[model samples]
Target chain A: MKRILIINPNSSEEMTRDIQDFATLYAENEAEVVTAKIEDAPKFIETYQDEAQAAPGMTRLIQKNQKHYDGFLVACHSDPNLDLMKEISHKPVVGIGESSMHSACLLGDRFTVISATTGSIPNKEALARKYNLGKQLTSVRPLDSVTGAVDKLDLCERVSRDAIDEDGAEVIVLGCADLVGTSFELQGRIGLPVVDGIASGLSTLLGFINQALFISKVRRYGGHV
Target chain B: MKRILIINPNSSEEMTRDIQDFATLYAENEAEVVTAKIEDAPKFIETYQDEAQAAPGMTRLIQKNQKHYDGFLVACHSDPNLDLMKEISHKPVVGIGESSMHSACLLGDRFTVISATTGSIPNKEALARKYNLGKQLTSVRPLDSVTGAVDKLDLCERVSRDAIDEDGAEVIVLGCADLVGTSFELQGRIGLPVVDGIASGLSTLLGFINQALFISKVRRYGGHV
Candidate 1:
């Protein structure tokens, strides 16, 4: 059986548990899913500075654990330092933000990401630009909630519906790993395809695991390696 | 030293050479890229009937050669019989159409596919819908070219420009495998991201090879495997 390492890239144990549970449940009988987090990282990754601060810890974690895992999934919606992580690791390292956006593009013509706060919108937009999904992205709607807050479900559903109606969003992506299990309910309420970044990341990692695939180190980093 | 079998699905040796050359060039030192085609299939797959006719021969090719290769790529942009091919094979089976569409999604917000003929538009639309990129698709523009015709470059450039100017296409995907090697020129002329399906397919296959990844059999076929 394949083993996947899911790095939360944050210090929050609660968020780590949520990511682990979601990955383990979906990965049932396909592979073993394990979750880890940097002890020195921020409790929440909400800003560019937060992401920058968390990068070193996340990189160290991957370097330390790359040998035991078949593939790696970075569980943050921002996908902090994904390129650098992939460059150094021997395994296939996928970012949740990248995987969900790619999966959303496959699922719909335009997608809206529901973020944890309005402050997160700019970073998400930058990511869309980096991935070349800027035009395909309808908008980034904020839930105005802290990580692991289940009470924002109604607000999320309402904002998502508005995104579909006003922004012409054909799909919705839950942009925070903390919002792992909310996609199904949000999709049901909003009547659009809802993607959880954590699930998409796990599924992508599983695909790599089932095939024993990895990033071509020779072609990566300007083919200098 | 992974090997990828690129099956053109059609019987045209010229098209096969084009695919093999593209895959081999871009794959440089990454994997061994091999190309094949169905001996009795149509010269070009432009319709549902054509795809259906080619399916059996493609299936036979995969079944016979599945053991020698690390992965398989269906070289046709229509991704003929991709599901069935994946079902029967032990390795990752990616279709050029799927790979191009997925890659286009990563490189741009909205994309237009340039087809060989107007008759191929409906089929390309169906593929977009099948992959859930229907809404993200700006339009499907036809080149009005017969298969293997080099004279349609001007027409392709014109239609792609219109797609960018009028249809709001952020990316251009050459919808026919025969149109390989036209992307760089088209990108220069049209000022939009131009994606060549064959190259994208090979790159995706190489990523899987580097990681040894494949589709999870248990999840691929209604969880019956």
Candidate 2:
């Protein structure tokens, strides 16, 4: 079985557990997926300062564990240490933000990102620029919810739907890792593909590993070598 | 100086000259830009059979020439042999379709792609899926121009503006390499960021190389034999 190391660059073990459970459900017999949170990483990264603080801790974790795993996934919507980690590791590494945003494009004709904060919107835009997905993005909307950093799960479902109906978002990406399992009910309500970044990252990880295995077999037959 | 090897995977010497002239204009003073066309490669690949015939020729060229360049750019809008070439080349390789469409997202809130043939809409979609930019795309429309696959420079300005106005395209991307040098003027008329894929690819190459250089610098600071 292929092994995937998912690093949540925050101190919230509860959020880490939530993502781990979801990965366990979907990873199937195809792979053995392991999820861990950095003990020294910050809790609730709400600012660029928080993200900056969290990067070195996450990079340290990736450096230590990268060789043992087939791939590494950074489990933050902001894609906290994407460039730094991709540089250090030879294995395919994907951030939850990059993977989910990519998946949202496949599932919908257009997409609107429902991020945690207004400050995070610029962070997302920078990501869009880095990955070159800014044009595919309709808008990066901030839902006016302040208290739910990691505890509460409440937001305007209607506003998100309007983004789909009026603003032309065929897919809704829940831009928080803590938003792992909550989006399915929203998908049921909105009647459009609402994506959880954690699940999408896991699915993409599995796809990448399976693709690598398939290519390895083909290379054994005098291909791509 | 950063070195870019821009390869026109066709036998058209005229197109090669056009691309070389275009690349020279935008490339930085610290960059060395050069171009070559496959003398034995197919001319004007307009259909799948033509593309299929051309892929091997292009692959042969990549195998022969990829070693000397820091970056490789396939100077065709169709982006023939894109994935296969990336798998083969150790250096950062980009195709105009891959680079421009990916770059389009960086320039605006939403964008639409205008290709040369009706069949290419699906081709564009496939590229979107491959690169994970499907969500940011407004639409991929084709201009059923019977002649001059993408060099209809005069018509591009008018059609591209219409696409931006009618389709809510905040950014306009010149989808074909033949439209490369002309997008800046069209952007002036359209009043949005216009992306020529060649420029986009060149920029992306620099971005990737810069990241690689940073990583290499970090590596060099540590103990090395």
Candidate 3:
């Protein structure tokens, strides 16, 4: 069996464990699913500054384990430092954001991303364009109800429902790695596919490993490893 | 079983049959793959003029059969009338070009397209950009060597080799519907993933059918059918 290493950029062990449980369950005997996070990184990666601060530790982790794993998944919805990760690894590095968006595009014409905050909306939209999924994205709705009024999970469900009724989203993407465990429950309530980056990322990387697909190392991804 | 209508958009019964055979084989009990072509369309879809000429017949066919098929696959690599078709149909319409590029993105970082003529290069590049896959595209190489000296299949092999060596392509997308049957043989020789849009499109539509995923019927795809 092949091995795939999934990295959550934040230093939150709780979130990392949640991602691991979700990944292991979704992967389900396809391959061994291993999860890790940047120990020196922020507990919460809510800003561009946090992404930058997380980069060095994340890069070191990827470089150290790139050869040990058949593939890597940068399991963050913002896909922090994804291109740089790909450049340094010979293995296929599937970003959670790209996987979620691309999988949603395959399953539906349009998808709405439910984010942790309004600040992450532009980041998701820009990544969607970069990945060629801009047209398929309906909108990015953030869970701004962080005032401890509604349960966070309930807020996600409400935002997803609104996105479906108003934004015409045929699919929903969980835009934060910490929300990785809510996909199935949310999909059931919203009556649309709710994509989790961790699940889709693992599934995509497994496909690549099955097909023996790797990053192009001739120019853009060359010389860094 | 779910039915997917794959339209060739050309007046060549032979090519339509070729696509049908390939689709039927690849689909393999997942979904019923039905293939057709415009009786009034050009014998070949080599130029934009050909696509324009083929549009009406293709549109009529899709409109007539939209209710019968659970999904649709626009089999030509140019994906002629794709947006219009989506606007008209409630079911999901999977474009071959879109499928090929998106699947390649999921599998690898970069892909090269093999087109039938130099005239189609711009079309493919533009489509790639429109699909947000322009950056992942290494380059488009046309089979302008239709000088009748070498075999067409051999020309494809040589072009693909050049693309891998010079363009740093990790994957190859056959850019014309006519090239659909050549993917496996070419992949064998090239030792890289050569994506046949028909197969990927069929696979994609089947996934949608299984998930009960449809085009969002609220706004962009609302009230068309």
Over A59-113, each residue of candidate 2 has an lDDT whose tens digit, in order, gives 7887788679998888889888666665566565767887777555433346788
Give the TM-score (vs. native) of candidate 2: 0.50
For model 3, how does the per-residue alpha-carbon lDDT over B123-147 read when each residue is reduced to its tens digit? Answer: 8999888776789999999988445
Off by over 4 Å in 2: A145-156, A213-225, B1-225
Q: How well is each residue in A115-142 modelled by candidate 3, as lDDT tens digits?
A: 9988888888898887767888889998
Q: What is the TM-score of chain B alone in each candidate?
A: 0.93, 0.83, 0.93
Question: Best candidate per DockQ, number?
Answer: 3
lDDT of each: 0.77, 0.67, 0.79
The better candidate by lDDT, 2 or 3, is 3
> Candidate 2 has which clashing residue pairs, if any?
A105-B135, A135-B105, A136-B136, A136-B137, A137-B136
What is the DockQ score of candidate 1, to 2 decimals? Answer: 0.06
TM-score of each: 0.58, 0.50, 0.77
Least accurate 10 contiguous residues by lDDT in model 3 chain A:
A216-225
- Which residues of candidate 1, in runs, are more than 4 Å off? A1-43, A46-75, A78-96, A100-225, B145-150, B219-224
Q: List, residue by residue over B1-225, the lDDT tens digit for candidate 1.
A: 778899998999998998888778766655788999998789999878888899889888888988999999888998888878877877777788987887665444578999888998988999887766787678999877434545667778888877877887877888999989877777667655577887777766654553334453432322355
Worst 10 residues of 2 chain B by lDDT: B213-222
